[model samples]
Target: MRIFAIGDIHGGLRALIQLLNKMEVKDEDTLIFMGDYVDGWSESAQVVQFLMELSQKINCIFIKGNHDVWCEEWLRTGEVNPTWYMHGGKETMESYEHFSNEDKKKHLEFFETMKLYYLDDENRLFLHAGFTSMHGVEKEVFSNTFYYDRTLWEMALSMDNGIKTDSVIYPNRLKHYNEIYIGHTPTINYKSYLPMNAVNVWNIDTGAAFFGKLSGMNIETKEVFQSDDLPSLYPNESGRNR
Candidate 1:
């Protein structure tokens, strides 16, 4: 079976649907999501619902993103982080405003089940964002850096042709895995409108939550697929644009 890794959705349900359709996923295929499934757009609730349905049809792995953790905190404690709301949480809250109690519970349950990272038998690591070191996943679980760090990507990009200085020890933090896949940092940040690969790390968050397209990559083949620009899909609203 083929393995597909999807970047952050950030409430872009339409773009997510479009990308999934393009992938032509089969029941036997494995789907790994890097998270940030909500926030940014006006359909955060709908996006969660769609994923709930999709999971019933295929084997799905969901990684918890920073935004997703914020969502869960708000759901359980009725407290909101001002920063989160200012960024994209407002739209996410608006999306869930009219949901029934049962619907809210379902969404919370989905979020609770999301993993912080997944290590496959092939030695590939899938996570919402980069990790600090390769010591152990358990040691890094409580650190939000797994869902918010950019240093790993930056470190990879800083490498000259993926070669590091001799002073740096081998099997560095990132090299522990055969390949590392992440999505919290959008590729657009690097001025590339598509997925960016440096060394063995692949950043697939093509900025669909902003002014970019949703992207999905075939983990085994490294073939990438993208959706139409997201802003074009929701003309009436600005998606996550400050």
Candidate 2:
């Protein structure tokens, strides 16, 4: 069976569907979604709904992202913080307007059930954002760090040749896993629109929430599949400015 890890979708339902169709996923294939499933484009509600249905058909793992935390707050208490709204939460809120109370509850339940990070049997780590350190990554103290940190990627980016022998900074950073897959910090920031690899860490979030493609990487083979540039799918929208 094939194992795939998908990056931040950010409400790009059209792109998500396109990529999924391209993958031609089989029932036994496992799909690990590296969060930020809402808050971009115009279809946040639809994206969540589609994933809910998709989970029933296949082995699916969902990670929670910062945007997802904001989404959960909005759904649970109707709180609309400006910071959250500014970063695509406005679009997400609008997407839920037509939903019935039960439907909202279903979506909320799905969001609440999402994990901060997932570690497979093969020793690969899948998370929305980076971790502070490899030590205690599986523990509860690192739960928020799993979705909120970016230092790991920064270190990966700044390191030469992606290999670190000195364990002074982060003792187990390089030896902890076979590979690490993350989203949140888009690859566009690196001036590339494709999934990027620095040593064993892979940043798959291709900025679908910000004029880039939605990406899916084969975990075993590291092959990539991507959708069209997201803005091209919706000409009128500017996407997330921040």
Candidate 3:
């Protein structure tokens, strides 16, 4: 079966739809979404609904990103970190103007049910964020780490900051795996994949939330497809960190 892996959507439902339209994916094809489905754009709720519906029509593997984790926590505790709010949570909250308490609860439940990582029989690993362990243990995967260990979160943050090297600490020891697909880190170019190191880890985040293009990569072919009208939201590229 052909597998198409998509990057962090961040509520860019229109871009996603456009990309899917262009792909002309077959029913037998598998679609793996790397997560960060909510926040950043104006249609977080719509994106979630679309994904929920799409999950039924195709073989879909949904992994949770950092933004999704914050979404879950906010729903459960009614508390959110300031950094998360600044990043994209505010826009997500704004998307659900008419949502009822029941609707909110259901959405949170959906987030809770999302897998933090996915591993295929082909040994391909898909995660919203990178891993922390060097042993290639299943428990080291984000699915288990996020729920059980805070150190994993810290490692992700450190990697982002360039304070730590992922290659050194968690060498791509899963040599048996064909590739590890990840999101969360926006690429300078949204239409292509970015490599974190010499490892076969692919970062497909097209930064659609920032008006950049949405992207999809065919795992077998490494072919990329992008949505039209997707351009860098910020001309200077300075606002991306915001």
lDDT of 1 by residue, 110-228 (tens): 99999989999999999888887667455665578889988888888876664653336544686568888999988888789889998788998999889999998998888999988
- Residue 129's lDDT in candidate 2: 86
lDDT of 1 at 72: 89
Count of clashing pairs, candidate 3: 0
Which regions in candidate 2 have their CA more than 4 angstroms from the true location?
A: 139-142, 162-171
Q: Tens digit of lDDT per residue, candidate 3, span 171-197? A: 344443667777666664434334232
* TM-score (all chains, Cα) for each model: 0.95, 0.95, 0.79
User: What tens-digit string does per-residue lDDT give for candidate 2 at 1-242?
Assistant: 99999999999999999999999989999999999999988899999999999999999999999999999888898889899998899999889889998999999999999998888898898888877655637543657777888988887887767346554654366568888899999999989999999877899999999989999989888899999999899788877945
Q: Using lDDT as the measure, which candidate wins?
A: 2
Clashes of each: 0, 0, 0
Local distance difference test values of all predictions, in order = 0.88, 0.88, 0.71
